[model samples]
Target: MSATEDPAAETADDFPAAPPLPWRLDGSARLGVFTLAQPMEAPSTVTAVAARRLLVFANSYRGGDVSYDALGVATLARHRHRVAVVPRHLWVDDPSIRRAGREQASTPSDPGSFAWSDSSARIASGQASVELSWHVRTRLALPMPMTFTYFVWDDGRLGCIPIPGRATGSPITMRINHWPDHFPELAAYESSLALRLNFAMTVRPQRLIDSK
Candidate 1:
């Protein structure tokens, strides 16, 4: 036997407590991280870890690259979430629908011009998860016959799947018990760096709600 305590036996008390909600990052370098508050403007730094905390404040409603009046989300190593920010593009290809065009104020009817909003665990499970959801208001038509996908954390592994109904709407539903064993290496590479969201909707949704 040695005369030292086992380092692995340390309890929660051994480490410093985590900061409460709306806490500052303090001094961590925000290089690859991004926060979207508008579709055509720039994203503001809500919390910067430069010193203690960098709290970003805004009242413009919309400033980042999103389609709604207000667009904002928090991205961190631990978690992330979003509300009212529609995804402009999807990195992974889904077999449910075909790309018509891109989102634009000029080409409203072109499918290629529209991006389907999505959800995230961080954004939905606010306690300690990334809950991402992009609301498309009551005017624009849904991307009918589309499928949304949600990618969960795989201990730094890459993966993708259909967005569950809970993350999307009542008519849709999905569940994932474990991570895929063989996700494409290309996607896995990106997952190691950051979390991304992609959504699919009907080009003609019957009941678009203004949850905002």
Candidate 2:
């Protein structure tokens, strides 16, 4: 019997896992634009929005959502407050991770924040939520470094966050099963490249930057 056929067969434990910078993640992500829509959802706290931004979606064991990061995507925010909606979580587990997110990392005060399911995938906070379905197209590859920039908006201020990581995985296509109503900026379109990844990443300390 196949794992999909057997509900009990699919578990993150069945997938690859690294130390996690103290948090190892196994999940699928989409790195594409809202093809049909632009100016995707910007956290409520962000300044007046213009120009569409890159869209990203990921459902991981750690949990979080995306933002208008010109370069990197913050697909790892589990604590959904109400801003760039930036995030952090725990194994709270990895080494590169301990010093990695030392600046702005945070974990869910409530365990329910990161729980989706064995048969399903999702991550939710107060103002945001994303449900995902992933289809793998390639095999896992050797680990490599990945760097991204996530725009963070919090406490009425916006900043740029630099994230560095090492990862390896298969090519994947993702389907969005659900999204929160507050995030009506993105029109539903399923799947895109990047990878279905096994990785450990760290969020460098952020610097306050003006978003023009």
* Candidate 1 lDDT for residue 154: 26
Relative to the true structure, candidate 1 reaches a TM of 0.17
TM-score of each: 0.17, 0.49
Q: State the displacement of the C-alpha of residue 46, model 2, in Å, after optimal TM-score superposition.
A: 10
lDDT of each: 0.20, 0.42
Q: Which residue runs does candidate 2 get wrong by more than 4 Å?
A: 1-33, 40-54, 59-119, 124-129, 153-158, 209-212
The ten-residue window of minimal lDDT in model 1 covers: 101-110
RMSD of each: 22.8, 12.1
Expressed as tens digits, the lDDT of each residue in 1-212 for candidate 2 is 00112223333454343233333233333343343254433444343233343345443434322111111122322223422323322111222222233324322111113444433455554445556566666665767666665555535465666666667766666666775554434545564344555555654556766443
- Tens-place lDDT per residue, model 1, 101-156, is 11111111101111223421211111221222222223322332223332222222
